[model samples]
Target: MTALPPVVDEQTWRDALADLLVREKAATKELDAIAAARRRLPAVKLPEYRLTAEDGSSVTLAEVFDGRSQLVIYHHMWSDGNRWQCSGCTGLTSQWTRTGALAELDARFVVVTNGPMDEILAYKKRVGNEMTWYSSAGSAFGADMDAGPGEGFAFNVFLRDGDDVYRTWHTTSRGAEQFSLFFAISDVLPYGRQEVWQDVPDGWPQDPTYERWLTSKDVAALYGDPEA
Candidate 1:
């Protein structure tokens, strides 16, 4: 355990908050500019990629667009011979279980993983996810698109134009955290994710020692696998 922040007078806290507002406003504007730039980034034409669904149905990358112009594929982390799922990937799915914006924005969002089709389906069922998921194993989709080596999480953006699919953008590792709201909320917590690496204030409650205590398997054990 670590000591909590000290209680200060209201006026003193107000002054500190007012000072922080300047930085917050600047960050907001900078982020807005970055998004604008991201929207303008050029896209690359994709190949004739084929992926399989949990039901063993064959689907093309363009088909994944599902008639939507914009498509977002969440490349979940799973691998062959690995029994446990990626904790970060699991965290992302757990937080972002559903979204109404897919239809509103003329977009379809799906999850993809290289894990065995059966294992992916079992994990999906265990997690109680309604989102459509696909297996990109033995497919160029994962290898060519930088989804990482079987156990890496990534958010890949795609665009569809009259039956042709194009790769717009993709982010992996810590950058993929943008797809998860848990990180944003965690940023507001006093401990701030409780990870060993964060440079939080001294004496803050956190796990300074790195360990595997927080992971997808932990989540599964705590929440109970729905399939089981």
Candidate 2:
């Protein structure tokens, strides 16, 4: 067990907390400035590409906007043959099962993978997600973005102007970690993700991040909910 902080009078504890609060406030302002700069970054015009829908229909880049003007595409990591998408990517996309409000905000979210249409539909049905799914099979869309399906998972943002589409921004690797709220919640716990990669006090349980799936079953176990 970790040792508790030393007992101190109220005034001293308040002083120590105020000192940390100053640094926290400064960090918040810096993050706000960074976000402002990100908004101003220039967008590039994307090359022509077509994606396949679950029904085997072709969906163009402009059509993906779906009259919303803004589109957010998730380049899901996928595998061939009997394999499925990367477990991490599957969990990441499953988090977006409910995105109806995005349409109201004039933003659309879609999933694009290199997997075949049938494979994509099968997995979607298994998980019961409603987000639009598309296949980039035999399309330059994946290669142009440099994250071809199974190679890596990425999030891409696009903007539509008249009949043209522009690549506004993109993020991958650890930069895209913010999309998964599960990581955000785990960050606040005492054990702090319980990952060996994190620096924690001695005796804290540690395991590789790959082992922590944090599935629906895990949630049901915690809350003892029979319906989950």
lDDT of 2 at 195: 86
Cand. 1 Cα-lDDT? 0.78
Error of 1 at 113 (Å): 1.0
Encode model 2's per-residue lDDT on 31-134: one tens digit a residue.
Answer: 89988987898999987789887778897888878899888888987776533446677667767767878988798999888888887776665555567988
What does the lDDT read for residue 26 in candidate 2? 100
Model 1 residue 147 lDDT score:
76
- Number of backbone clashes in candidate 2: 0
lDDT of 1 at 69: 92
Cα lDDT of model 1 by residue, 116-219, tens digit? 68888777766655678898888877878777464467788999998788888888867876676877888777777777788877887666543533576666
Q: lDDT per model, in order?
A: 0.78, 0.78
Q: Which ranges in model 1 have alpha carbons more than 4 Å from their true place?
A: 209-213, 221-227
